[model samples]
Target: MNQVTNHTECSSLNNAKVAIIGAGVAGSTIALRFAELGINTTLIEKGPSLVNGPPICHLHAGGNLYREISDQQCLTLLQQSIDTVKVYPQCVNVRPTVVALPLTDKGEPQDLLPRLEMLRDKYKALVQQNPSNEVLGDPQHYFRLFERADLERIAQRELPKKALCDEDWLVAFAKQVNFDKLKFPLVLVQEYGLSAFRFAAIVSLAIERLPACTLQTNSRVIDISAKENGAGWQVTTAVNNDDRVNTAHYDYVINACGFKSGELDDMLKAKRQRMVEFKAAYVAHWPQCQGLWPEVVFYGDRGTPQGMAQLTPYPDGYFQLHGMTQAITLFEDGLVASCEQSAQPKLPARFIKKIDHHWPEQLVNDRTIGNIAHIAQFIPDFTQAITAAKPLFGAQQIPGDDPDLRAADVSFHESGYARAEIVKASSALAAADAILEDLLESGLVTSALSKRYLNEHYFPVSLQCQADEVTARAEQLAQERNYPIALANIF
Candidate 1:
């Protein structure tokens, strides 16, 4: 087994070797944290690039999921995430936009208005009680309530005319849309549109620069087993496009591979009762969309095939439309049939045919057409705009990537192992904190040294310095190669 040692000022973790599987946001964040803590950390990724899967459209920093469940820890993590991202201003596009949720008039037993009102009241009281709290910033700036009049005023200038004419449309569908028993629609602030690939690239580049970090791209972990002596773990990996196999020993391993973690270890498989297949498509070259737009979430009416749709704009004049569907049984013969059955009325036959012909291995791409069709109902121009647009990327169903994953009970199979299935990017900070706490409690590292390491590396100065360095390197390479340094080229 190949063992690596860290030669840093923090000697407590100098001999500690850790391996993090996968290089998505969660995995990358954990690897960065460990690397910054002077541990001999290795980030293993199977893809050619670090961030190779479906694009992450936006970053929800204002406690969107936490506010729903009233989780105080989640809320604190959300704030830390926002602050961490702000340190890299050049890599991310931080925009102030209201996330508008249009209330539908479709008959449903549950009263959504009162629920929203109660939530608003709860947050309002929190703000009033602790005006100086960092997690719950100024409530007036963070939370907003948009009445019918405000919606109408914004619709006139923002929404297409055809959307207003269609009562069934999702956004600004009717002139007098009713929010039964409520004064108006609710909006959340501090939402930002992020270039997912760029953000990941920045972090990956920073990880590579760390003296204690080893980024092994194109390396797939084939097997991981406990050492014969029960002291650590022996990980066997197969390097892509190569016949040679390598083995490494690490004191700890973090499975941050999202849905793919199950493939590495049976114990890590998500025991989800039901799995919802979420799909999305990248639609680009929409001339109508000139600048940034709000991250819109159109709630689905009960009993309707419509579940939920998210429209997030990108800096490159492109947008992503995604949503969830009925549960699917993956790796089974009926997987395709189940996806087709759930994506009806929204997904067009042409789109489904495209997925069947091009990417049959994917279960979520089949729903891309349905998601686009659903979005077109509200934005009439969407249908026409899509004709000129092209499909850029997509991802299949991911278990444990849901908003509720954080609320689930956490259990570890091994003593020196941890799994960070952080579904939301904002939860990355909290996930790192949890892993460090576990390591300290498990006697893997000293508590005083761990705390000091965390305090020094939580918001590392290296990340802030890398922004300009990466930008300069990218621009230099673009100039040397005589190619454009646009977002598309760099990402």
Candidate 2:
């Protein structure tokens, strides 16, 4: 345990102590952010080291667009992602991403025009709102439209010889790449292909170096309970490989344990139901690409079982080819007992039974083969691409690794624990913001000073603007409707 720094005992903080369970990217980011605010923070991880856990390499900046999110929210998230790179440049690899639209029988790219135009309009609107926003330089420059001939030229120069010249291969590949489907192919610059392991390592290092923060590896939080007097929390942790149980008290607790957050939430009497789902994908690491292939995402057709296939290049001369299939839902009833039992000092029989019921150990090989076949459409070499073919969950212990886990679980319950989903590393920023806002309103810290700190250090320019706009819009809407405003309703 590291000695607490005197600076952490600031009057505004009222000698606040925060314990963040799980040292994944989300927890680590929050730990570092809180430490920077001169708060005494502790980051606990069940694993021996941060990088020893699950693999999460893909990172989306502005390139990977989602229809579900509002344009303003998307831009805000993108800016936060970019800001992450700015803060830790050495931990990421910035690269241009190419999203290939399907081609029609007439050899035209399908849906390219509408998609590109939509993006252009969206970018234009963002720039119109903030003329001086230079985070993403000129939107036109970054979002380039490439013609069929240009794409052919690029393929000829970059694709493998067999893929470039073979008529049969070309015909099969053409079905996947429709030049006539769209006016032109779209290219997005400033998107990053991150090394997840490296990013986690850097964050872990930063947390350890903070004088007011402590990094406790191999410490698994078994239970968290609110103090009887409601002043703080009592967190009980079971140290791995040691028959010992240690308990600590804190003013705040954040459950960034990724999948197992729901289990931790239960300990605090937070009864939110978290639905679990599993998607299997295999990653093939090729020694080298035939040509200068940047990160490529092949959009699946309507009938395709797999949703999409993404090829991400690493600086280490290897590409991670991923094929995402439709998710398999894990029934909520199946997980309740297991999740609850896992939080106890001793593991329950029902918990082990439940884990075996849902574990995908039998389908590992088949899932890997299926993923390889799906991705092989674009990269023919992917059919024979060298890969471990291990179940992704096999990379780390399953429900046993952390019992209360779920896929991309981010839920804020009445309990003090803020569960941050770790699917995208950038999710940490959102989680930290939520936690900070709660603290501000609780008067643990002065709102004005905290807001200044957030804006100056953590919040991106786009996010700041978006927050203000959302607030104003919500207020206006509330006045118009003669009702009180809620952030959720506004969004």
Candidate 3:
């Protein structure tokens, strides 16, 4: 169990309360920022503190999981805004990987070889500027272009023999999986300096840091509605493993739940157009192979770099590899759309075929040994350490070169999602916009700076229904109840 401490309460909002559903990175970060600004806030999470999967895409990975709209610079500014709200230094860290793009079906190098050569040289120059070896925002460390020969040699010499590994194992180890000339996102978070965990710790730490913020794990929000006085919103939760129900009221309610955003949308009567869902994978790893991984690798052959899986270093010398897809518009309650493969992608089909063909036999006998041995094939680091290993889940012993992989049973902590292609602002930025728009229309918050920030930070309003209608109704409801419903004056 983790312990969180609260600080002195503030007098802002005259103690008016705010409710934020979901305790992931976005929710908790927002809550911390609000609390720091003297807003009384409560952050509600429906599950345990952390899951053994990947973190959100944006914080760690360089890619945006939402639509990639125009005005990409605003997107950076928005993230910087969230980082400002962070009580701790940015816990998320990204590492770079070399990606190969295919030029032809016959696997011949693309005619754009000269262009790629230039890019590779440019990338090397970038790395020289910032040599952290971790890929966060450092543009130089994000990605590099590699040639066909670079990949072919890696495949033939590093990958495991077909007879010894599972298909997935082979594909992953060989680096034969197509990861087009795409930039993948990777993140690392820490509980304390040098004590790294995944995104969950970051959220938990934020909640603990809040003075009066409550983080109820395993508590589910079953119902929510408007308060009678227009004072705020009322929320109900089922806790104690959903056996008990409790209700609370707050002056404002924020829906930051990821996939569950739609449920809150329904409760608030928010337009269905305001909610969207994209498909992502929750990836876990098999036991670690002895030996330190070389630079983590990513492979996705889909044309246009929809997404790619990459290896991320974990504490105690362990590593996690996961993949993500690009986010497309999802219909209400509809499945996330898949992407089409690139016309000429660099995915190594022969390598995949070899792995798939041999996987069944390996699985039939000595599955554990087979998985490790398979990974060892492509990763020279792992291959060198395969001998004299016991069947254990966590790392029993750490190799000299890798201090992070010494533990047994490391948690799975990688996540990827389909990203929105349009360059758009983050949700926080969007909220800022909503607030400004409300103020502008209501004639309450009128300031040049405020408007500038709103314009600069605001993402394209994507809500399907009329924003005007919703704003009007909310104002009317506030007026009837005598609360500060003049939300159009939110600034």
Best by TM-score: 1
- Every model's TM-score: 0.71, 0.70, 0.48
- Candidate 3 error regions (>4 Å): 1-13, 50-54, 57-90, 102-198, 229-231, 274-307, 315-317, 323-491
- CA shift of 77, model 1, Å: 6.8
lDDT of 2 by residue, 1-491 (tens): 11233223322444577888887777877776777666678889997665333445444564353333344444555656645655544445544566664432122344444544565566567667766433444566545655567556544533443322222123323333445544354444435565554455456545555676788888988878889988778988898889899999987778776556656856666654443333333445455434434566665531235445666654333445556444211212233323443442222344344333433445545555666666665556666655543432312222233332322325565545566655556556666767877777666656354676765444121122233443454345334423223211211
Task: State the C-alpha lDDT per candidate.
Answer: 0.53, 0.53, 0.35
lDDT of 2 at 336: 31
Instruction: Give the range where candidate 3 is weakest over 10 consecutive residues by summed lDDT.
Output: 409-418
RMSD of each: 8.5, 12.8, 17.9
| Per-residue C-alpha lDDT of model 1 across residues 344-461, encoded as one tens digit per residue | 1223444445433443534443444555666665555555444223333422323333434333212355688776655556565566777877877777776366677654344353
Model 1: which residue pairs collide? 346-370, 347-370
How far in Å is the alpha carbon of 320 misplaced in model 3?
Answer: 2.0
- Residues 265-289 of candidate 3: C-alpha lDDT, one tens digit per residue: 4555443322122222221233444
Q: After superposition, how far is residue 183 of candidate 1 from its true place, in Å?
A: 9.7
Between 1 and 3, whose lDDT is larger? 1
